[model samples]
Target chain A: MPAAVDVGELVERARRGQPRAIARLLSLVEDGHPQLREIAAALTPHTGHARVIGLTGPPGVGKSTSTSMLVSALRRAGRRVGVLAVDPSSPFSGGALLGDRIRMTEHAVDAGVFIRSMATRGHLGGLSVATPQALRVLDGAGFDDVLIETVGVGQSEIDIVRLADTTVLLLAPGMGDGVQAAKAGVLEVADVFVVNKADRDGADATVRELRQAVAFGHREAGGPPWRQPIVRTVASRGEGAGDVLRALDEHAEWLADSGESRRRRAARAVGEIEAIALHRLRGELAGVGGGRLTELAERVVDRAVDPFTAADELLTNLHTT
Target chain B: MPAAVDVGELVERARRGQPRAIARLLSLVEDGHPQLREIAAALTPHTGHARVIGLTGPPGVGKSTSTSMLVSALRRAGRRVGVLAVDPSSPFSGGALLGDRIRMTEHAVDAGVFIRSMATRGHLGGLSVATPQALRVLDGAGFDDVLIETVGVGQSEIDIVRLADTTVLLLAPGMGDGVQAAKAGVLEVADVFVVNKADRDGADATVRELRQAVAFGHREAGGPPWRQPIVRTVASRGEGAGDVLRALDEHAEWLADSGESRRRRAARAVGEIEAIALHRLRGELAGVGGGRLTELAERVVDRAVDPFTAADELLTNLHTT
Candidate 1:
């Protein structure tokens, strides 16, 4: 049964870029509402147009400031933007400070811009099954760009990279030790590196180091390489914002020319579908208490059955259900 | 289909606490070798014994130093210990700089201690499906304790916390800002907090801040609370090592008393089983590339079907398979 408010009407209004309708649908996603299936089905045809951009970096690295500035740049270009700032909540505690929202206040009144912060509170890693669906909602709502900003350089940020058309890694100067600490982790996900705070003392050195690290990392990976561009920025001063956009445009063009866009999107779709299906299967398995799964796990613990065979047996039963 | 080395023989030797045999079995886990299922099944009876401890902090908080000191203390009590230092490698570039190994070499000649660094290369997060299996191997091999050290505050470390019986969150005096940066991410996993470098000026301040934060986090989470004890240590000098061990023992007793141990282990088992099963399902789907799965994804992308329905159809086919 759908909500008392006709889901059909909401979909139509959301498609026309009505903020209220989009907000309502996203809340549905967040709540895991029963009628989300209907909403997702309704959002189908208008999807896949927005270029999803993921922005991530270590904590205290100005990810929020950069995101806000980028939203301004996109708006200046006459593009409607939707931002999802994913916050990783304290593991012991289920609260998110969300202080980053303060930097984005400039975009609060602009209808052309939509910004929301999502705390990865209950989810093991941030970006639950709801995340991709949320992106689809923004995509379907005629947003030209969807920017995802995840807090910290952890697993959630990496997962976010898989869904983005381009991933921007933000860094700042004089964070030499910090750069050294996270460079290896960030190298894997960065499509474009932004050394923000270029007005700081060691900006040139930081940029140079990053370039070298990127080159070295690419070589080690041993792929036919597309070199990740390192762009310097003073996001506080709004300098180098246009260059970042230009670099994104170039990457977009490259993706189109190589047909990598289609392949990447296809792969992303497959991943999302697999994740959802697995989640459902897990739910099904969990529903049966003191059931076959527990017995099998105990047997595996006791060495009565190999994990693979136990897995096979579980899967066989899964098929019948 | 087993390796020529006679897996059964190795399992017996490892059970007898032959360090070399244990090392060989752990290598099998790391490689994801074909005989892993056999190894896992064989090791099941010997497990449920070793207390797995996870040691993690931000990059430069001296996790290795703290781990080494902890190992020293554990060995002094005549407890056999195994250390799995998880290295988070770049996703794009399959490389890990395992500098942490050098610090633990002081224990190289000590027969009761085993230290190995596992690099998470080509795996999205460093702690792969292999990690739990590796711990099981060490567990089965009669190690009284297995200390797992991860490099940074990321998703892999969080996953590691799931497998650990007690997770030690390491901090240092001058790491105030760094601690603040990672506090929320680390809060969920910390069972005991160790403020290393106690000789430094801000040691007491860091300890004070952590207690306050821990209390705050607990209040916010609103659970049956376990008070995480803060211990100060100058790990390099081996000062306060005994206190750290006391805190761990207290936590261990608390876990057993509360029956949280069983719940945690059961939860861990459920997680491992689910991960393995999901891996198999993803493999099954990938094997049928450009097949029904892709079609379903395309349908979902086109809004021809909701993701849930598409997922259901996929699961149905998976069941039949």
Candidate 2:
């Protein structure tokens, strides 16, 4: 069993803007150790203070650069920001490489900005297992804004929309088409659509295609009330970053006015708690019966009997024993 | 509530090659209706008859073409084949378009060939809730071989390899150097690597790069007993299909001789059953409490409290009630 973690101390240290404590707390939660639950329960009240935004797209779409530019722009607007750049988990070690953090050295020394690279840590959904808890910590730590950058637009990636007030889908010029976007499942969730690397060829065509795609799918002629703005940005040069920020601000306002923001936040809270519960149940179940599950599984595989029946018997045993 | 299904009758109809019954059985398992447990129990005794293979790669890597060609080749070899092409779920209805089956229409008339397309169905791991159960049904129906063709390579795609007796990774020409192969999580899982679209530029380079990448990763000079053969093919033209089949045959022999085949199948069976159990439990939980779980989830988003604690409380209530 893992050692018990001190929830209060970790929260206090994180609130004081200690990066290491924040990282450690996130690690504890991502690992799904029993103690992380206590820490998350304590941190819940601290969330809802920071405006969280999500950035997602296919790999090699310049998501990291876009995030850096967005952070710089938010700082220019006089807001303290926290960034969580999530990398895909390693299949072998089930850990993340955290490679994207190497690209964001510009904000490391700025006290107004806190940047951290989180790995999925084998969470089924693309978000970090402890993301909601970590967001709460950042909220209590007094960050005015939080930006979550995901590696790809998998189902897990869509989970970001639930956690963020606004989600920006980043696309690169000369990449895929509207069908590809639909396939990635990004068009449905994005509040803002950005064609990054706008200086590249086909930028206008890609933007037009995205607009048409959105128009075709929108229920109303004027488009959904959120108005997913398609902005062109050369993130590498920080060009058009202001427009992205403006779009985000406008969307934030829309969210507040429509009262959907509060509802989404509540839904996100429930999802986070459910995720934690599932994680814990999986762990606890794996530990029961002195690992008899493995033996029974093998027996089922050996054709001694069927797995469904085996599982039923196990559940029955759990009930009676 | 969905209507209860008859497992034995459905299985018997599917065994007689009734497409509607097969489709209905698949839907029942996919939706996690309570009857799936009974259906799976009935089908378990009939599995272990099909030689399951997994095909996976990045988008536009010619996975569909390769799968089509492979099915054709297997048919020519006098084998009854079943193909399950896994596509992303439709966002609107959460159903698959079943496009792959349409693409392979030539095989539709052939009684020996059965093709089905499965959607991820909201599972984060990319496998549908009913995949394993569906595979079992197909197997029980007397398919000499079953091929699981995944549309994209994500974490969930890796799960396909664990389910198959032999796993093939398809790579398109000009998809970057062998480093791209390594980075895409294909290098570790593939038993056979195919440099598809041989007519395209960089086909030779891709093959050479893959050879070098495999060499660098292999600790032993002989290549880990199961050497990943790099086969070049223009799957559209059905070129090099013979060599691919021969390579598969050799790999199957190798696996059997080394006892890896039995071990892999056993592991796959356990995993399939566990996944089915988890799927069933999720559905059961979703159906309880008059959907209060979903409502509480909304409350969590509203910031009433943290999700971790809420989930635990919900699970506790579920267990007690």
Candidate 3:
């Protein structure tokens, strides 16, 4: 538990766009400090205003470079922006070059832009719990737009799709990333696709392949009918960033008209609440005498009872205890 | 709920190696039929004898081919084998192209072999619930070896490593798979690394890179000193299959000698029990009037209370109800 702090003052300062206060609040969330509940309470009113966007793709698809370009484009439109670069790998390794931070230094002096890199300290569900709270903090701080950047590799990274209102999957030419994305089930989560480094030799081919893949990757029969557009960009030279912005705007509008944004946010809330609830339940179960549970497990192993029955008995004992 | 099943008779037949009875038991588990509890109760005494192995790797890495060859080798060694090839993709998609089934035909008619393919139908944690129960059925049926095969592309697939006593991670040359494996954090989960397609060009390089990666991927300080072995196998020709088997035997010996096997199985039991318990809790939460949870969420959204506090209220209300 953390010492009692003036959460109200922190919230006020953050609401007034004080970067240090906002950073402190986010740190509290990331560290799972006891003040987090107070911070969440404070920030609740100012959330749901920012349009959260997720950017992900296979490694080396210039995800960071494209994210930087997206930031510039959003800032040009006079919208305050925040970026979260998520490293899906374990934090213990600690060699995260975070090369993207170098690319993002252009916005280092801008008060309207915030960038942070997040890593999981190998705790299960660590990223899932922290990322959303950080987003809320940024949203409460009045960032009109928040961009989440992550490497699209494993299951944990796939979680970013749930947090973002719109997910952009980036790929480059000649990487056979389209197939890899499908295998990873990432293709199904994409709201929009981008072929970065379009000036490269295989840009057109990549775009064509993505278009074809997206065709077969259609949602359910009665989905919004918003065709996932594939745009090509050369993020290095800042070309076609505006097109991505336009696509985002179009998706945002579709989300609004289709009433999907509310549903997505509601679903996200339900998932988070359930996860927290489950975590608490696990804690309660752990506090139960290990000998009792092991005895029941041994009974199940010895053919005296089924696992479901053992589980039922355990739960019953848990509640009574 | 299903009709009252003659669980005692079914168990007796399955114990006598009746394939139909075994199939019926597995089906009950997968479908969550009411008879499942009875079946589990009947089979509990016959469990914990079979050696469970997990085979996983990226796409195009000859995972299926290698699994097939491994099954053949085990059969020749007079071991009855069971395979569960899990497809993590949604069942609604209907494009699994599990073409590997064709390659497995060589053993299709072998009375000593059993193979089954499973899909999730997009239910979260569906595979987790079903896989273990099916393993129990096979184990109770007197199978000497059970091989669980899955495409290692997502987070859910990673759970397979926890379920198996020994996990074999397959890779091939020239795919930059070593680096990808490291990036995906698969290097850490591997107990045995197999370079499939050992005859391919760059096979030696892949093997060397894997050795280096495993050397560096040492487990936490003062943990088990088990060094992961890297083996090369050309599964198409059944080459090096014996070596892979030898490695598995070595790992099995190590697991038994160090008391790691019991600890692993106990941990696995605890995890499964917790997951099932959580699922029940989620169901209870869902059964709560949706409007109540939504109102609480709205209050959180409006900054009236933190989510934790709201969750606490919900749990209290649930207990009272």
Candidate 4:
């Protein structure tokens, strides 16, 4: 086991914009370390600062490239940015994540940019459970913006990735992304739609289809509906990066002006607290009754006790600290 | 509000293989009824009698068609079959599920078959949580076989679908499925590989690539590792279904002989029990301290309390009955 460290001291260093401190905090969250509760307690007050931008789309849509381009643009705006590339691909293959990291090497040395690739492995509840805590670490560290770039082909995966201040759904030309996006049910959560690789064939067609879809889908209730703008970009050549950035800024403004920012942040906090509690309950239940869960499972298989009763027994007296 | 269901009476009817009773029980599980605990307790004693076979593949791979063919084949052998087509596709779009139901219309009227399409919505843990309970209902209803066919595009989604006694990973000709399946990290969970649409061009190539990939990947550590068999089938034409069934039976024998069946079932039971406990806890927490979770979330947003502390307060005295 790693030696115990002072979480308060780490948080203090992190608040001062120390890279090592932020990295350590993120590792703790990713590793599901025992000190997480303490880290959250220390970091919570300093959070609620970063503008979280989630970039998601189907595979081969250049999500990583778009994220890298955004990071460069955000740095140029003199903003400290953090990037968490949540890989939703096969856990057995690290090739995509490896390729993503290589593509992000240009910003690796820039102090204003912090880039990390997160694999969805061993984290029960998948990306949602781990990403929120990691996002908190960046928020607590005083980053001006945190970009969560994930492979967002799956519907449930897209819902999990919607825990962001501004979610930008990226699509590429001729990928047949409009119908694909509708099929993935991602059009509902996206605040901004980005059509990357705009120089490619059928870029206009993709954008036109997306525009039609946006107009067709019902917007969220109440306060003036901020129309989702579709931005065109060739992220590989760093073209239209400024346009994407402008859209993001405009969305962020709409968010604050319409009071959607407050609602989104609060909803995010609710999800975060609930997820943390669930994670803790799971840990506690696993170790309860001196290894009861496994024994209960055995009994359940033997027909000695029903699973519901077994679950009830496990849940009883699962006291919180 | 729906009338309170009679749990014991329903179980008795379900065990007698009454279609209406079985459908009602499945509806309860899908709806996350408050009487789920009662339903589970009533159903547990009759479970463990069915063979669960899961068919999963990427979109456009014809999982639903394969499932329909397998259902007809199983019915011919005098085994009652139940199919749960769990849709992980866009929640807003029911087109795929509708298409699947239409294809299974022949089996819909068969007294020996039960077919249902499950949307992965309103279920917090997505397909995994809702599916296990649904499987149990079928098992208790005296079905000799339960086949779960789902779109397994994402890696985490595949892990959730592995709650089967034998998992069949489907591939198609000329879809570049070999690399795509590997990329989805699906190669690890497959017990048998089925190359559907075998009459199409590149069928031999797909099969050859899958054989090579299977040979390269490490098997689960155990006695006499089962070499995953590749079965070719034209599901749409109802050809080669018997070959796939034979492969399934062979794998089932291997599983029982290797005692891996016991392990997988026990592991699946553990996950089921835990998911039930978590779902119940979430319900209780949402009402705890008279909506204290929302209040705590508001406080966290206002920087009045750290999330960890709020989570602790919400978890405190959350007594499970």
Global lDDT of each candidate? 0.74, 0.69, 0.75, 0.77
lDDT of 3 by residue, B99-138 (tens): 5346778887898998876654443446667788888999
Over the stretch B99-154, how does candidate 1's per-residue lDDT look in tens digits? 63466678999888887766555442135477888898899889999988764455
Q: Clashing pairs in model 4?
A: none
Model number 2 iRMSD: 4.5
lDDT of 4: 0.77
Q: Which of 1 and 3 is the better model by TM-score?
A: 1
Each model's Cα RMSD: 4.0, 4.2, 4.0, 3.7
Better model by lDDT, 1 or 4? 4
lDDT tens digits by residue: candidate 3, A120-162: 4443346667787888899989999998877665565677667
Model 1 clashing residue pairs (backbone): A44-B303, A90-B184, A91-B188, A92-B187, A92-B188, A319-B319
Error of 4 at A16 (Å): 5.8
For each candidate, give its TM-score against the true structure: 0.88, 0.86, 0.85, 0.88
Which of candidates 1 and 3 is the stronger one according to lDDT?
3
Taking chain B only, the TM-score of every model is: 0.86, 0.85, 0.89, 0.89
* Candidate 4: fraction of native contacts reproduced: 0.44
